[model samples]
Target: MASLQGKVISITGAASGIGLATARLAGERGARLALGDIQAEPLQKVVGELKAQGIDVIGTVLNITSNEDVDNWIAATIKHFGRLDGAANIAGVTTKEAKYPHLAEVSNEEWEFVMSINTTGMFYLLRAQLRLMLPGASIVNASSGTGLFGRPGMAPYSASKHAVIGLTKTAAKEYGPKGIRVNAIAPGPIKTPMLARVYGETKEESKPNEESKPKEDLKPMSTIPLARFGESPEVATLVAFLLSDDSSYITGTTRATVTGLLGPPRFWQPASSRKSTYGYLPAGQELEGEAGSPRLGLTPAQKLAAAEARRLSQAQKRAQGQLHRAGIEAQKQERLRKKRVA
Candidate 1:
């Protein structure tokens, strides 16, 4: 692990998912942290948990879309830590609708809402961080795989993420001379709250119920070479590396943690042209057997193993769904109790 000892790092969206994962990992690697989020209760809860683990940390509740909020949070971080060595701009949101609407159907309000947080808010945070950061400081911004390629019915989101890449590259070129580095990470189908929401899964469930299947056409896992969702900690590890000296030579590039989903061969080929056995192979072009016949499908043992893996995965998701429901109920009860006391 790349050590972040004594480094003072600031992170946005630190209340949950990838942001929360990064905060925990950075703290464990000995970094002093300033965490900001729109949710005060969850942010404080996370800060308290980290503090108990002996991590040097502070929490601030602020809307990233507000310039004043973004500026004040950065200023407060510098005041608390004395200096900022690194930052992870991880705050972002998707379209409000459960099903993404076509560009023609999307209203101005929806477009502005996504752009305000994902693009303009990022600009505000980056400007403030750059003003205070010294040479050798590093910053990592969150982009998305959609940023690289257009997704149907996600015009606003795709445009905003593309803007993220544009800003990251521009910042890197301008700041590289001063010894500062800027980069972006484009993640695909990470197992986070955002993904859950995108899949139409409610807070009470990890997977969509039979009646409420996801509105999107793509089956996310089936398209990916990894055949599973990327985990939060996996992306956090990359962010940590970018923040540390380990990635000093790397800047201005958008690194993808997409599990080969965006690899040239897979991405360029049409779905109908591809087949998956042990790996992705062009249709009817797999490895040949000793008799020179194409090996078209998995062996019986391999099929059994695949079946067992899927069964276990479904079981895990069910267990997670139960836990999610329990947590929500607990929160609801707590809120009611507080209301009663007041």
Candidate 2:
């Protein structure tokens, strides 16, 4: 919680929810804030609230799903604040893939639209911000428990979230050696406008608010050990840590349990360590868990709860496989410590 005084930070999807909470937290920490979103009125309201409280803030009503808008927001941030220190790549979208989609009936337009905003949009903003980021720069991408887990109605959302993990990992590896830390947050359900839009209408008109909402909340929480949805501010707290020096030693990590959404994806432990749990071993060797966990014909819980860890492990294996087959020699570059230890 070091003072963020004079630190310049940018956030997308800042009009509401996680982005707005983050802006508030960042401002309270003395960080200068540059915020972007497609909703002009709410975006301005947030900026107005911050400015009234005497926090230095600039709001740009820009769609993160647009490359031009991404570039413009970056330019606006530097123009208004004079420098960039960190960013929260939080803007996102969902498609029918995550809600009411038929695998064989998915329209091309719907598929492309979701991928563009949720995946490409994040990459666009990060790239734009990186161009002007100062040393020790950090970036946090907003991911979801859904990305790590598969929901019956949310494939696009899950896929997009999965892609975010991939992007953050690659960026962390590429940038950490240059003193930039990149990470992601895979949040569980939060009762944002987005969630209200989905669940609010599902309840019967006669259902009492207290009883219904609690039941609705518990639906997802049943999967979570904590048994609750996280508040937007909760995720904001961790994003702040990743941006600050407090997390200097960490990178390429996607912290997903902030909302107690689900545990890391289930993995296939080495046979030598198997103790006969659904997927556990005798416990002597390090669990090379999701590194090779396959999704083919998985059980229902396995598909949703441990999917992200499975994807991550698959990606890592692919990388290692390429490195071995190519036979290309490469050296690990140092980022923080200058001297290579013997």
Candidate 3:
């Protein structure tokens, strides 16, 4: 087992989804946790469970979107944990895609609210964290696959996620020399409460294959290449890795979980290579899963391999171009020699 023993990890949005799942799993691994959430009841529930399982944890009710709240949250972490070694900024929100209301119709209040929680909020928390972060600490910011590739009608969400990538890279560069690693996770469609809000929150409810429903043709699953959504643990596993030493060599990159939607390489044959993929896994398998059951797109080795491949490909392409040009010139010289002989 990877020993997270004695590590002081702080996570925002500890109430649910990836945040809550991360806290639970990290606790099981023996990490001391400073967990924060807006929802006090649920957050306390998590704390209760962790304590029951003999995990060391401290719970705080924090709103990451607020600057003062963010400041206090960090203060509390350092006061309680003595030093901060890891943090995961995983709080976010989502809403349904609507048509009658053009994006321009979105109120500034709404826009700011979304950005406050998704982008600005994370920035505020991260800045506060970097102050107390020890050398070799890690930070992870949450981006989204929707931001990686535009999703129609989610303008606010896309904007926040894109900015998240910018923040992650900037921090990675700034802290790399200091031994702190920063990275971003661009999660695809996960079956969080958020997804239910985004894709299933319309008044246009439907029956399962019953036909005669007006919006029956508007099933969003058809577009998701894997035909299902991911669970919170799918994102949490990657979160844990980024926080752990397993990914010490990895930084400055935005990793994603395109669970139902495969990568660019599998864009065409979504079904062919995808057979090897466990597209979000079925409920039966998930319920009966053992330790480390979920595998996000790339295993740790595959992630390293892909990174090496990208580096090699760039170098190979450059050399190939140079050699090809030299070969063309040599061929021209041979033709000139033959003509002179003629």
Candidate 4:
């Protein structure tokens, strides 16, 4: 475990889910916490519990969608802690618009609602943290697996998450020189209240008597090799690692907790049948050559074609490298000629 001893870390959405798990873990690891959440009661309850456990902690109720609220929370954190060491931007939302509706059918209201909190609000919080943080400070933003790949009916959420990655990478490059690290995590199907609501699994629906009854199909689990949902603490561990000095060299990257589901299920193949050279074939397509096979399922001729394609790609890269070297030589010669004339 990475030591966060004496580090002052601020966490958004700390009232529940991964943020709550991270706060508990970070506190146990000796970090002083400034937790922010939209839920005032839950946030205070968590803070009081942590305080009882002898964890130095404070809670702020603020709306992430408001720049003023975000700024005030950061200000409060700095005032209490004296200096900010790290921050976790864990606040985000998803709507029923992500239930696989056609892109054209998605309501403008839903789109704006998701973007306001996930993207614009992230911009506000990240901007505030960047302004306050000094060298060696770290920031982790929450993204989702949907961010990396386009999912049906998830236009707004996907677009926002992709933007998060773009922001993380851009900030990493800009702030790397100053020794501030920025990164994002793309999680898949974590068992949080948000996900429970998405699956229509409310507390009433989760009673012991209802446990014997069949529930709605969990489509996301079909794609995951792990065959189960991830726990909040599992993600919290990664967040803690990123915030600590343990991941000092890691920045400008999005670590995925997707349980091996890289993309859509259609793009995946079983591990046993997977071939390095063959690459990914569509689901339900066998690799063996056969008549009337799926388009993605390669035959001998297609395999040969793929090999030829690789050969051509390698040749093109080599030619591009040679041209690049020649261009550098030309620039050097031009500089030498200019020096001689001078």
**Which order, best to worst by lDDT?**
1, 4, 3, 2
By TM-score, how accurate is candidate 3?
Answer: 0.70
Listed in order, each prediction's TM-score against the native is: 0.75, 0.71, 0.70, 0.75
Which should have the higher lDDT, number 1 or number 3?
1
**Compared with the true structure, what per-residue lDDT tens digits does model 2 show for residues 80-154?**
878888898887765532233434555777777878888989889878877777669889999887777554345
Model 4 misplaced regions, further than 4 Å: 96-100, 203-218, 262-264, 268-342
Best by lDDT: 1
Which prediction has more favorable lDDT, 3 or 4? 4
Q: After superposition, how far is residue 33 of candidate 4 from its true place, in Å?
A: 0.5
Instruction: Kindly report which residue stretches of model 2 are placed more than 4 angstroms away from their true locations once superposed.
Output: 96-98, 202-218, 258-342
lDDT of 4 at 207: 26
**What are the per-residue Cα lDDT tens digits for candidate 4 across 113-160?**
899999999999999999999999999999988788755446788899
Q: For residues 1-342, what per-residue lDDT tens digits would candidate 1 score against the true structure?
A: 798999999999899899999999999999999999999999999999999999999999999999999999899999988999999999898775544665787788889999999999999999999999999999999998878875655789989999999999999999999999999999887888887777766555444434324433344454465667889999999999999989999999999886444343343344454333112333333222212225424434434556878999999999999999999999999999999999
Q: Summarize candidate 3's per-residue lDDT along 1-342 as a digit string, tens digits.
A: 445668899988788888888898788777899999889999999999999999889999988888898889888888987998898888886432222123666567667777889888988988898877878899988898865764434567778888899999999999899999999998877876666444334345411122211122243343355556778987888888899888889999999875333233223322322321112221211112122436335433334657878999999999999999999999999999999999
| Candidate achieving higher lDDT, 1 or 4 | 1
Span of 10 residues, lowest total lDDT, candidate 3 = 281-290
